[model samples]
Target: MSLPMLRASRALSGADMHAESHAGAYADSCSSAGRVVARGAFARFATTLALTGALFASLVASPAVDAKTAQPKPVLDASAVATPDRYAADAAQQMFAAGGNAVDAAVAIAFTLAVTYPDAGNIGGGGFMTVYMDGKPYFLDYREKAPQSATRDMYLDDKGNVIKGMSLVGHRAVAVPGTVDGMWEAQKRFGKLKWKQVLAPAIKYATDGFPVEPWLQKRREFAAQNFGGKTNFDAYFSNLKAGVVFRQPELAQTLTRIASDGGREFYEGQTADLIARQMYGHGLLTKSDLVQYKAVWRQPVTASWNGYQIVTAPPPSSGGIGLIQLLKMKADLKPQFDGVELNSEPYIHLVSQIEDRVFADRQQYMGDPDSYRVPVDKLIDDAYLAKRVEDITPDEVPGAVPVKPGLGDSMPEKAQTTHFSVVDKWGNAVSNTYTLNGPFGSGVVVDGGGFVLNDEMDDFEIKAGVANQFGVTSGDVNTIAPGRRPLSSMAPTILTKDGKVSLVIGTPGGSRIFTSIFQVMTNLYDFNMPPADALAAMRFHHQLLPQKTIYFEPYHPIDGELAEQLKTRGYTLQGQTFNGDVQMIRIDGTTPQPAADPRGVGVGRVIQ
Candidate 1:
């Protein structure tokens, strides 16, 4: 086993290490009447000295065994967390400071985001989390499930024709949420903090009110535009105003109940009752559905690329498997990026072809593992990935080549999700991505729960060979069934080198999540870029079934002469808005370097 090498990017200050001592220098040296207040002076001096002594003591306590230089940057010597919201990151940092491991911090971040980032971060939604505890990896699948009444053609009309937006919008769209149970389960099994303590920050944020960011307001307006006249729309948006304090009293109360009773309250108690009542005449979820819902534990999908072992969510989430497959293919092709210029024509074209090839397999082979036989072993096989790479061309674009799903001589995976990464002082690491499916998720809030319901039912393949919103088409493997989890693109991944988690990366974009995480991984490992540069780098996405074009972000420097170069080669290029808000934490040497996606308004915090 080897340790990570550190890079000098920023410096840490003495005051940043200890604030009380700096302030104590100006404290009252003597009290009024001048009784020679030696006791008070000595107490304050002693306190300051102790605080400073501990600061240095902690540094000396750890050997910095991984440090290459005589002295390493202090900034890289601390625990850190990164999330899509400042409040949520703060919650995670607080947990870490309170002697919590990555799992505990993750639970805190999960609940805090539900309150602060309502558009995607949610308790009403569900997702997959990959946890690395003591160097061993585990996966928790809390993906939202189809209701018991769900059927293969539930979203189809009489003639077996798929309903366009039927599964995306109303009460029927809501699934039995598993996020609450998922968080509780992870915390109970691997967390170091009490369940209630982990949820306290979120409860306080919801009840005491949090300032509405511009992004949240924009999302609110977007929801209103699409679902203005829908039932309960006003209830969730009545007090939503930009740049003002937005309080979720109902959500706060619900959180309070969950805190006191553990996650059981959400699954079978008051919150579930409210959800049932809200869907009584409109949705398919019954009290029984809620009570029966449970988050299952799955072994994490594993693969290797560039000396790094990868652990990620499996099966129901095609993201991880897809990423591993893509990386393997890239490694086989070994396309040199000419000084790592990712925007170069050969690099972009080769990578896009790889994406198209994998996605073609994804549309046909992936589904919930418990519901069907998924050829996970065969899909990630080196020979299979090498064969998939052969379909790609180094110079010309591989325009929509029909790549068949590999058989292990067996078989093969789609989000409006939120993702966060946490690495505590301990070696424990967590990468999680959860969501409500769409912007406001079904555009309905429970009557008294003050939470959005996930329309995850739409994630299923409504009909064979038809692409959903994320553009991945599926067969019966992903067809709706009672208690079955739909295919998803929520890829929460951890990369370990020599048995130590080196990088935790994930993102939120329906289909883009897979490509986004893949890009960042390549950027860091293959290209050897820093975490921030890796995330800030311009990205492109390709889905095989739809368009067969590589969608480039607007920020990509491929206009004018460079853009025209690709046009002559039959490369279908489409310039579009940015895709995927990725969150990453890189454990370098003795420090944790966290970086939030620059494309989003999220924040990263290094625990001091």
Candidate 2:
């Protein structure tokens, strides 16, 4: 057990305020004007200082790293990233500028993110992607699956009851990996760059070294508790706990091998051998399973929302179904509005109703299309959508009413994953979402792999109402079966108008991501708000699981009777969780305006 060296990148302005007098210098100095006499002078000084502070905070929190050093010039060009860190973005951007299409760039960047930011995402995670080309769109479904040896009752307890499956630690909690194979397959088909070139950045970051972003550091600190005190994990976290930078040399070397050999190197080469050995020695992964693992690249689902055609990942990616389904429901209501109106009851009511129906469908029949017989077309059909919308009136009921959602029948929950979106100069766009299912992804980093493996297979319903590791339960629709892709909410979405891309967008908020982006797009096109304002607008989420409507305060940003109009709709509201990270680019004619969500350290780069 050894601590890999780390590189923590940061620029500190001294330290936390210790002495009040000096605190005034860094703090109140920013706005700490007291009754320093002339009293009136204080007000003016305070205002100026406050403004200065705001400017400083703006830059510090800005997604675009200040031109501080010779780090690397960004060439992402209207590229927005929501990966765990900047290194991921850099690796991705560098690839894009080097002639790699979004496919090449994204795969490069994603591997870097997995290695550098392993707490929330990594190679251990599996992902979903949506690609658009010519006049059509395609959904790339390379979601992770259970090992062939995995059983319907593998997650069951002593009483033959299904316990929360893969949310915890150890090999038995693992799901067969699909990320490497998925990335390789996508890049080979759509990327302009060669597999070796596309993989170079991630390989280098892993093999050589890169600085750890503050966010990565913080996540480690929190995750340290969960890792317990295993010698290897202890060595890993002790460095992170003390603010020491950590890197993944072993993982990098493994990635380098994969880059040269492709997914085969990971699943069937030395890496797969290593993973299988660990699984067999520690719990259950079989060599046959590793050898059989391969990535899937399929067509994405398309939907029309208010005249604009949208594209997203399909089944195996419930995100596509859920995203389009909810929009279809919303469009059915025919709610009309001009300009921004956040948290207004009518707006909230309409969105909530649509969300409720969409989620109900998700619960019923959204899973891997191969194993499950999902009437995806029926689920997302306008006729069925209109029927569901007709079920809702101007009332706020408990949402428990049995809404008969069409689409054949139910499927189990798809494995969870993460998302990323990219648009380069060729007018080509890629919207992607990848995940390890949850933070730390079963909390098991593949030994010498420097990445966590996804427990996505646990997303299936081993039993009706059986809770997963995250304390979330699965329904009949999300139950598992052989060769089935589980349901998911990681939506890599986009909107095009006039045959030009209007918005390259997506987010990562479990079931809530659908509504969050839905609101953002509605705000931009339907309401005509500026990019920043549209992003800042208050939002709401309806998952239909707990059945209570959730609304962020900012969703109702405008004041006056609009607020009153909302309350009359019988809305059950709460404070905004505000965790969704949405990145988008709006094409205003021939130009592009890029905006990244302020929820974290996201940067949107324009080619100009």
Candidate 3:
């Protein structure tokens, strides 16, 4: 009989049999060598019969399955990595294949990105790393610190007015880098591979060159146009083009030195001399600043939310407090969202309102904990957040002027950042978000280092209450101070369920980082959407200062009716070209399902 007819015949014959009976029959068919030849035929027949029964049962049980049920089953028994670039993902997979744990893969990915994705990934920039290992959470704060010469009003003029572009492009804009030290510290503490092994892929890419993708090409063109002839930027990046091999011999040498001498090479060795020399006359950083820069291990900001344990970046990053507060407020107001469809008019309005409140609190209360007292515990207190959101109404939107910081205490770090998530077979996970603050940060490449320095000085509040390039305003708590880390929005987060890593996720979008993460979490837990759909879902952002305006992604435009409904409720709907690039992995029963944001040229790989 034909295959279809055979399947149909089995389906009919097994119509009255229980699924257990089919399983028993299949086992019986494989019970002896005499039945070996018939194994294939019996197996096929049993599988067909089982599937037909399952389909019929499902159809009869629920005619209209929700998105959660309709989604494909999670990939089983595999490790995964999700990153903003294909090459970085491949590098991470190589480490995994070589018997590396999550930390090793993470360290490998970080270094590789410095070579393949230089716009944000950098040895000269710094960011946060959240790691879950040995049933514990750890946060590494290698965020760039202000130079010792940095002062509160350094970016201001004789007239006390803020100078435009002073803090965005030049040697003066660069902060002391900590990425090399951060990676080294993480590897030393948790990695299973040798430091040289972790950095091999990056050195290979830098030495052998990698293909210039469209995103890197665009960044190079932009740098050339705006920062041409400014410094070594033009000398190095001016010639790179798309679809060509872009090699950085100087960078390869620097990476090799770093691999050989360890992270100290960048902070105290010849690399430090090169950086100090590059900034000597025109900038604030000195070799002393580089030498003093140290990546700190801080306790991760953690909370329990809806049965999942949240582990994320602590102070210096407003992300952890912001995320916890948002989640808390959402939970407190859960009753108001009953019957509202996800991403509907009411849903967007409610979420935006909650976000605005959090942003308000962030502006007033968040800062580098070492330099200023950030009341993290008080900021995320359920009672404080309750009071912060108690005034919200479904129909009326609050004006920006009226939204003051709930507790007077005060932060954007930049959207031009990159994030990656990794998971290994042993269940350890890492969510890392690093940045240069702006594209090709500071637009100042080290003369011999061939790496971009961060424009993170712009992240500090150059002038309190004044909006920065990303339109996020902050207060005095975030003002610059010597050796202080700027308040950051980079929240690399991990979530655990029942003591196992459930989610490893993070993204790059200046002021929108935490909100983007919050929304994704809600999508996964609240809406029960699969990882892929949850990531691809439309995203909107509100920073409270943009005042009554809700920024939605143009790529995922709001429905006409929903937009009109939101407008009728006093919201100014604005479309931003991009919201965020979220790289995440969802672990379901020890299997990982990786999802890369569709908005960028990223890849999500499942490693067998």
Q: Which ten residues in a row have the lowest lDDT in candidate 2?
A: 20-29
Stretches > 4 Å off in candidate 3: 1-76, 408-415
**Candidate 2's residue-wise lDDT over 428-494, tens digit each?**
6777777776656655555544455665766677677655543344466566555455667778887
- TM match of model 2 to true structure: 0.79
Off by over 4 Å in 1: 1-76, 335-340, 408-415
Per residue, candidate 1 scores C-alpha lDDT tens digits across 1-608 of 00011011101111112211100000000011111322343234334434455453343223222345342223236678888888877777666665566787788888888877887878888999999887699999999999999888888898889886778888999888888889889978987666656776676565446777777777778876766566566555645667677755556556656765668777777668878998998988898999999999998999877888999989898899899988888888775434546767667777777887788778777898887777788889998788767656665446635556655324332216888898866667899999888887887777656778888998998887788876678777888888899999889999998888799889998888988898888888878898889988888887875554667787554668767767766666776665888999888876888899889988888887
RMSD of each: 12.8, 13.2, 18.2
Order by lDDT, highest first: 3, 1, 2
Model 1 pairs whose backbones collide: 76-591, 407-410, 414-489, 415-510
Task: Residues 212-330, candidate 3: write the lDDT tens digits.
Answer: 77777787788667665675576666556678776655565566566656778788877798899999999999999999999999999988889999999898999888999999999
- My TM-score estimates for the predictions, one after another, are 0.85, 0.79, 0.85
